[model samples]
Target chain A: MKHWLRIEAVCASLAIRSRMAYRLDFSLSFIGMFLAHLALPIYIVLLYGVSAGFGEWSIGDMLLLTGTIQLARGATSMIMSGLIWHTNERVQQGTFDLLLLAPVNALGHLLNRSIDFEDSGLFLSGMLVFIIAVVISGITWWQALLLALLASFAIMFFASLYILFAAITVRYISTLRLFEFQDIAAQYAQFPLHIYPSLLATLFITLIPLAVVGYIPVGVVTGHLPMIMLGSLIFPVLFLGFSVWYWHNTLTHYTSAGG
Target chain B: MDIITITDLSKTFKVPKRKEGLKSAIQSVFRRQYETKHAVKNVTFRVRSGEIVGLLGPNGAGKSTIIKALTGILSPTSGEIRVLGFEPFSQRKDYVRHIGALFGQKSQLWWDIPPADSFTLSQHLYEIPKQEFERRKNDLVEKLGIQDIIHKPARNLSLGERMKCEFVMALLHRPKLVFLDEPTIGLDVFAKQAIREFITYTNKEYGTTYILTTHDMDDIEHLAHRVIVISGGEKVFDDSFAALRKIAGVTKHVRVVTQKKVVLPKKGVRGVMHISPYEAQFVLDREILGIRDLVKAIAQKTEIIDLTITDPPVETIIAQLYQAKA
Candidate 1:
C-alpha cells in the first residue's frame, strides 16, 4: 500500500508536469472550468428572478444546491478528470496494454494518469459558494458535517458511475455516449428532486442517484428531508460495489486494438 | 531449464463482417455477422534459459498473436503456456514482473516528457532499489550513448534515439525474459547494429532470455541462435539456424579468383552460377561436396589468389520454406 501511494504520487507529479508543459492550455481549461461553474449560479439566479424559486425552496436554498453540485463536479473533475477522456484515448490507441504490464495496481495507475490538477480553481470557487450557502442556511454544525460527508461520497458516486462507462468504453469503443448520459444526469441533478414528477424524483434518487449526490445533501443541510440523507449514504456504496463488479467482468471483454 | 513452455497453444479472433449496400447495413445492425479467424493454431515451442529465439513469419501468419499471448496482451483461446513458472494470462501480474517487452510500433514512453522521467517512473513501477536503479540507469545511458538525448522529450528525439531509451527502460529492471517484437523495424543500419549489439551484450552478460519476432532476416542471423518459422498459424520449423539451413537444402556460393584460368568441374558440384577468364563462382551443397575437398580440387588446378564462400541469404530460404509450406 505504501508503494502504491508512492506510485500514485509519481503519476500525479508526472501529470502536473505534463500539464505544466502546456501553460496556455492548462490556464485556459482551468479558467474555463471556473467560469463554467460560476455560469451555473448565474443561470440559477436568472431562473429565481423569473420564478420565485424551485418548488418549496427559496432562491438561497437553490443556490446552496447548485453550489453543492458544483463542488461535487469540481472534486470529481479535479481528482478523476482522466476517467472518461483518457480511458477512451488509451483503449482506442491500444496503450492500455502497457498500463496492464505494470506490476503495481493497474487501476490505481490509470486513475493517477487521469488526475487533472487544472481543476483546482473550480474546486476553490465551488467551495466559496458552498461556504456561503452553509452560513446562510443556519444549520447546526452536525448537519453541515453530514452534508459535507455525503457530498464527499457523492463524488465517489459520480466516480462509480463514470468508471462504469469507462469500462464500457474499453469493451465497446463506440460507447463514448456515456459521457452524454452523465451530462444529462448532472443537468437534472442541479435542481431539487421535487421539480420533477414524483416517479421521476424517485428514479433520480434511486435508479440514477445523481439527485442524492447534490440535491439531497443540501436538503439534509437545510434540515429538510433528513430521512433521505440517511438513505443517500447507503445507495452510493451499493452502486459503487456494483460498478466495481461490472468493471472486473468487462475486463475480459477487452480484445485490444488489432486482430 | 526452460523459461517459456507452450503446448498446442492457439488463439482465435471473432472479426466483425461488414456487408455492402443499405439493406445489408440495416440487417447488420439487427444481427451482426462475425467471421472466426484462427490466428494461431496448434503451435508449440519452448525457450531454454539464456537463449535467443527468433519468430519468423509472413504478414498475418500469427507471429504477433503468439507474441501477444506470451506477453499477456491477448489470452490464448486454448492450450497451455507457462512463462517463468506462471500461466501468462492468469498470472499476468507476477509473470510480467519477471519479464520485459518492447513493441516497435507502440511506445511505452510518455510522449510529452523526457525519457529520463519515464525511467524514474519505471523504477518506481518495477520497485527497483534506488542504488540499483541509479547504477543501471547510468550504465545504460553511458553504453547506449544516450547522455545527450536522455533529457529531451521523446517526441523530439529521433527514432533511433527513442529506441535506445526504450532499451534502457526495458533492461532497467533486469528481467529474466524480454520480448523484442520487431525491435529493429524501420531503423538505419547503424541503429540496427547498435540495438543488436545491446541485445547480445545483455544476453551474454546477464543471461537474459529473448523472444524476437520480425520479418528482417538479418535480425535473426545476427542475434538469434535458434529460429522458429511459422506459417498459416503453425510452427513449420523450430531448431538451430544451421539445422534450418540444412533442412532447406540450401547451397553456399563459393567464389574463387585465381592467378590463372582454371577448369571448373561440371560434376560433383551443383553448378557454376558465373564464370570469367580468371574468376569463377559455383553453388555447392556442402552435404554433396565438402568445402575442403572443393578448395583442394580448385587449388590443384590453379594457384588460388582469393576465395570466398557465402551461404544463400536467409530471404531465399524463407521464400522456399513458405513456398514449400503453401
Candidate 2:
C-alpha cells in the first residue's frame, strides 16, 4: 500500500506537470467547472421552489442528494479522469508497450499516473452545499458525519466502476457509449431514488449502483431505509475487488496499437 | 547459460478488413471480415549474456513483433520463449526486473515533466533504494550527455537530447538485457554517432546484453558484431557481419575509366563481367580478383585515366538478399 501511494504521488505529479503545459486551457477549464457546479445548485433551487417536493424528498433533501453525488463525482474525476485520457492515448499510440515492459504493474501505472485539479473546485463546492443542506434540514451531527463518510466510500466505489469501464475501453478500444451510459445514470443520481419505479430503483441500487452515491446513504440519513439496508455498504468493497479483478483480466487482453 | 531462448516462436494476428466510406464502415461493423497475418513465423534464436545482436529487417518484417513477443507484450500463437529463465508471456514481475527496452519512434519519458522526474518514478517502480537510484541516475545522465536536458521537460528537448534522456531512463534500473528498436532512427549524423558510441560503451562498461532492431544500415554495421536478418517472418541469415556480406553475394565494384572509348570482349576476362562502354565496371569476386592484375589489364586498354573500386552498398546487398528470398 505504501508503494502504491508512492506510485500514485508520482502519477499525480506527472499529471500536474502535464496540465501545467497547457496553463491557459487548464485555467479556463477549472473556472468552467467551478461555474458549472455553482449553476447546478441554482438550477436545483429554482426547480424545488416551483415544485413542493421530488416524491417524499423536500428541497433540502434533494439538495443533499445533489451535493453528495456531485462531491463523489468530482472526487472521482479529480483522481481518475487524467488516467482515463492517458490510458486511451497510450493504447492508441502503443506506448502502453513500454509501460508493460517496465518493472512495475502495468495496470497500476496506467491507472495512477495522473490527477485533475480542476475537479477539486467542484468537489469543494459540493462539500459546501452538502454542509448547507445538512444544517438547513436539521440533521443530527453523528448522522450527518456518518452520511459524509458513506458518501466518500460511495465515491470511491464509483471511481472503481469508472476504472473498470476504462479498463474495458482498453480491451474494446471505445468507451463513448459507456460515457453516455454514465451521463444518463448521473441524471438519476440527482434525484431521490423513490422518484423512480421500484425495478429501476433496484437496478440503480444493485447493478449500476449510482444510488449508493447519493440515494442510499442520503436515504439512510433521512430515515427512509431500514437499518438492514445499511449492510449494503459492504458492496463497495466487493465491487472494488471485482473491478480490480476485471481490470487485470482486461489487461491480459490488451494489444497495444501503432509502432 | 543462455539469457534468452526461443523455440519455433510464432505470432499470427487477425486484422479486420475495412472498406472505405462512412456507409460501408457502419455497415461492415456488424459483419467484419478478418484476415490472419503471420507476423512472426517459427523463428528460433538464442542470445547469451553480454552479447549484442542486431535484428535487421525491412519495414513490417516482424522485427518489432519479435521484440514485443520477447518483452511479453504479445503472446505467441505457438512456441515457447524464455527470458532470464522466466516465461515472458506470463509477465512475472521478477522477470520484468531483468529486462529494459527503448523504442526509437516512441518515448517512455513523461512528456510534460523533466527527465529527472521520470527517472525518480522509475526508481520507485523498480523499487530501487534512494542512494542506489541516485548513484545510477547520475552515472547514466553523465554517460549519456543528458545532464543539460535532464532538468528540461521531455517535450522541450530536441530529438537527440530526448533520445539521450530516454536511453538514460531505460537503463536507470540496470536491467541485464536491453532491447533497443531503432534507437537512432531520427537523429542527425552527430547524434546518431553519439548514440552509437554510447550503446557500445554501455554494452562494454556495464556488460549489458543488447538486442537491437534497426532499419539504419550504419546502426547495424557499426554496433552489431553478429547480424540476424529476417525476411518474411523467417530468419534468412544469422552470422557475423562479414559472413552476411559473403552470403548475400556482396562484392567489390571495380570501375575502370579510359581516355578513349573501347569495346571489350566479354568472354576472356578472368575477373570481369557485365562491362559497359567508355567505362567498364567489373564485379571482383574476392577470391578471383587480383587488384594488381586488374589494374594492369585496364592499363593495357587505351589510357587508364582513372580507376576507383568500391564495395556494394549495404542497403543494396540486403535488398538483393530479400529479392532472392522472395
Candidate 3:
C-alpha cells in the first residue's frame, strides 16, 4: 500500500509538471470549471425566486446540496473521470499494454495516470458556497462529522462507477457515449430525492447510493432526513468494493479478446 | 537454464466481417457476422538463458501475436506459457516484474513530459531503490549519451533520441528477460549500431535474455545466435543462424557466357534466363549438380567464353522459406 501511494505521488507530480508547462491555459481552465459549477446554484436561486422548490426546502438548503455535490464530483473528476477519458484514449492508441506490464494493478495505475488540476476548481467554488450556506444555516459539530463521513462514502461510490465505466471502455474499446451515460447518472445528485418519484428515489437510495452524494448528506444536516435513510449510507462502501472486484474480473475476461 | 517455454500456443481472433456497400453496412448495424482468424496456430518453442533469438516472418505471419502472448499482454487461446517460472498470462502482475518489453512502433515515454519524469515514474512503478536507480539510470544515460536530451520533452527529441530514452527506461530495472519487437525499424545505421551494442552490453554483462522480432535479416545476422522463422501461423524453421543458412543455402547462382548456341537441359537447372543464345544465367542446386560436372557438361556443348558461380543472397533463402508449405 505504501508503495502504491508512492507511485501515485510520482504520477501526480509528473502530471502537475506537465500542466505547469502551460500555466496560463491551466489557470483559465480552472476558472472555466469553477464558473460552470457556480452556474448551477445560481439557476437554483433563480428557480426558488419564482416559486417554492421542494416542500419546506429553502433556497439556502438547495444551494448547500449543490455545493456538496460539486465537492464530491470535483474530488472524483480530478482522478477517476479523467481516468475513464484517458482509458478510452489509451485503449485506442494501444498504450494500455504498458499498464498491464507494470507491476501494480492496472486500475490503480489508470487512477494515477490522469490527474487534472483544473477539475479541482469545482471544489474551490463548492467550498465557497458551502461556507456561505453553513453560515446561513448553522449546524452542530456532530452534524459536520456525519456530513464528512457521508462525503467520503459518496466519493468512493462515484469512484466505483468511474472504474466500472473504464472497465467497459476496455471491453468495448471505443465509447464516446460513456460520457453521456455517466453525466446522466451524475445529474441526479443535483436534486433532492423528494422531488423524484418514490420508485426511482428508492432505486438511487438503495442500490445506486447516489443519495449520499448530496440529498441524504444535506438532508441529515438540515434535519429533513429520517434515521432509516442515514443507515443506508453504509451500503455505498460495499458497492465500492464490489466494483473493484468487477474491474479485475472484466480485465481478465477481456485479455482474451482485446488487442 | 531455460528462461522461457511455450507449448502449442495459439491465438484466434473473432473479427467482425463486413461486406462492401451501403446496404450491407446498414444491415450490419442490426446483425453482424464475425469470422475467426487463426493468427497463431499450435506452435511451440523455447529460449535458454542469455540467448538472443530472432523471430523472423513475413507480414501477417503471427510474430506480434506470439510476442504478445509471451509478454502476457494476450492470453493464449490454448496451451500454456511459462516465463521465468510463472504462467505469463495468469500470473501477469507477478511475472511481469521480472521482465521488460519494447515495442518499436509504440512508445512508453510520456509525449508531453521530459524523459527524466517518465523515468521517475518507471522507477516508482518498479520500486527501485533510490541509490540503485540513480546508479543504473546514470549508467544507461552515459551509455546512450543522452544527458543533454533527457531534460527535454519526448516530443522535442528526434526519433533516435526518444528510442534511446525508451531503452534506458526499459533497462533501469534490470529485468531478467527483455522482448524487442522491431527494435531497429526506421532507425539509421548509427542508431541501429548503438542499439545493437546496448543489447550486447546488457546481455553479456547482466545475462539478459532477449527475444527480438524483426523483418530485417541484418539484425538476425549481426545479433541473433538462433533464428525462428514463422509462416502461415506455424513454426517453419528453428535452428542456429549457420544451420538455417546451410539448410536454405543448398543452391548456387551460376552465369555462363557461351561462344555458340548451347542448350542447357531445362531439367538440370531452374530460372534459366537466356540472354540471346550466347549467354545465360541459371541457378543450380548444388545437392543435385556439381560444379565440376557442370563445367564438363557445358564445355562439351560449346566453347564456353567464361562461367561464374556464386551463392544467392540470404533474403532469397528466407523468401523461399516464407512460401514453403507448412
Candidate 4:
C-alpha cells in the first residue's frame, strides 16, 4: 500500500504540473467548476425562504441533503471524473495499451493518470456548504462518526460509478452521451428520496444506488434516516466490488483502435 | 537461454462487413453483417537472450498484433506465449515488469510537461530505488545527448529529441527485454543512425533482448542478427539476415543505356524490358554472372553509355516469399 501511494503521488504531481502549464485555462477550469456546483445549494437556500417546507423537508434538512450530494459528487469528481473523458480519449488514440504495460492494474493506472486537480474548486465549494448545513442541523458525536463513515461510502459509491462509466467507455469509445446518465443520477440524488414513487425510490436505494450517495448520509445528519432503509448501506461496497470486476471483464472487449 | 517463446499464436477480430450501394448500407444499419479477420495465424518463433530479431512485414500483416501480444496488451485467440516463464496476458502486471515497449507513434511523455517530470513517474511506476533511478537516468541522458532536451516540454522538442527522451524513459528500469515498433520511423538519417547505435549499445551493455518491427531494411541489416518475415498472418521466413538475401536469389536489377545493341550474358542474364534495341533493362544473377564477368562481357561487346546495378527491391523479395508459401 505504501508503494502504491507513492506511485499515485507521482502520477498526481505530474498531472498537476501538466495542468498548470496553461495558466489561464487552468484558472478558467477552476472557476467553471466552482460556479457549476454552487447553484443547487444556493437555490435550495433561496427556495426555503418563500416556502417554509419544500416537499416535506425543512430548510435545514434540505440544505444538508443538497450539501451531502454536492460533497459526494464534488470529491469524487476531483479524483476520478477524469476517468470518463480520458478513458474515451486514450481508447480512441490507442494509448490505453500503455496502461496495461505498467506493473499495476490498468484501471488503477488510468485513475491516477487522469487526476483532475481543477475539480478541487468544486470540492471546496461543496465543503463550504456541507459545513454550513452541518451547523444548521446539530447532531451528537456518534452520529457525526456515523456520518463520516457513510460519507466515505458515498464517495466510494460515486467513484465506483465513474469506473463503471469508464468500463462502458472502453467498448463504446465515446463518453459524450454518458454525461446524460450521470446528470440524471445526480439530479435524482440531490432531492429527498421520498419525492419519487416508492418503487423508483427503492430502485435508487438499492439497484442504481444513487440514494447511497446523498440521501442516506444527509438523512443521518438531519435525523431523518429511514430505519427500514438501513439495509441500503451495504450496496456501496457491493457496487465497488462489481465495478472492479466489470472493468476487467470489459477489457476483453477492447479491440484496441490501432495496430 | 531462450528468453521468449510463442507457439501456434493466433488472434481473430470480428468486423462489420460492408456491402456496395446505398441500399445495402441502409439495410446494414438495421441488420449488419460481420466478418472474422484472422490478424495472426498459427505463427511461432523463439528469441534467445542478447539477440536482436527483426519482424518484417507489410502494413496490416499482423506484426503489431504480435508485438501487442508479446507486450501483454492483447491476448492471443489461441496458443501460448511465455516470456521469462510468465504468461504475458494472464500474469501481465508481473510479466510487464520484465519488459518494455516503445511504439514510435504513441508517446509515453506528457505533451505539456518536461520529460523530467514523466521520468519521476516512471521511477515510481517500476518501483526503482531513487538513487538507482537517478544513476540510470543520468547515464542514459548523457549517452543519448539529451541533457538539455529533457527539461523542455515534449511538444517543444524536435522529433529526434523527443524520441531520445522516450528512449531514456523506456530503459530507465533496465527491463530485460524490449519491443520497438518502428522506432526509427519518420526520422532523419542522423537520427536513425543515433537510434540504431543506441539500440546496439544498450543490447551489448545490458544483454537486453529486442524484438523489432520495421519497414526499414537498413535497420534489419544493421542490427538484426535474425529476421522473421510475416505475410498473410503467417511466418513465411525465419533465418539469419544473410539467408533473407538469398531469398532475393542473388539477383540485381540492372538498367543499361548503350551506344549499341545489348549483348546478352546468356548464362545468367534475363531480359526484363526492351524499350529500344540499343537500350534495355535486365536482371543479372550476381552468383552466376559475377560483376567483373558482366562488365568484361559488356565492354567487349558494346560501348556502354550508362550502367546502373541495384539490388532487387524489398517488395519483390516479400512477393517471392509469399509465392513460395502458397
Best candidate, lDDT-wise?
Answer: 4
Clashing pairs for model 2 are A11-A113
Candidate lDDT (C-alpha), each: 0.82, 0.79, 0.83, 0.85
Clashes by residue pair, model 1: none
Scored by Cα lDDT, where does model 1 land?
0.82
Report the C-alpha lDDT of model 2 over A50-139, residue by residue, as the tens digit.
Answer: 877677787777788888887787787787766566677777777878778766677666667646787787778787888888887788
TM-score of chain A of each: 0.92, 0.91, 0.92, 0.93
lDDT of 2 by residue, B126-202 (tens): 88999999999899888877778888888889999999988988888898999998999889989999998988998
On a 0 to 100 scale, what is the lDDT of residue A180 in model 2?
56
Separate clash counts for every candidate: 0, 1, 0, 0
| iRMSD of all candidate structures | 1.6, 1.8, 2.4, 0.9
Off by over 4 Å in 4: A140-145, B20-30, B249-314, B323-326
Question: Which number leads on TM-score?
Answer: 4
Model 4: per-residue Cα lDDT over B1-326, one tens digit each: 99899999999988888779999999997999999999999999999999999998888888999999998898899999999999999899999999988989889999999999899989998989999999999999999988988988898999988888889988999999999999998898899999999999999999999999988887888999999998878998999889987765767788887788977678889867877987778899877999789878987899889888866665677998767658
Q: RMSD per prediction, one decimal?
A: 5.9, 5.1, 6.4, 4.3
DockQ of each: 0.44, 0.52, 0.44, 0.66
Q: Which stretches of candidate 1 lie over 4 Å from their true place?
A: A140-142, B248-319, B322-326
Q: What is the TM-score of each candidate against the true structure?
A: 0.87, 0.87, 0.87, 0.89
Model 4 pairs in collision: none
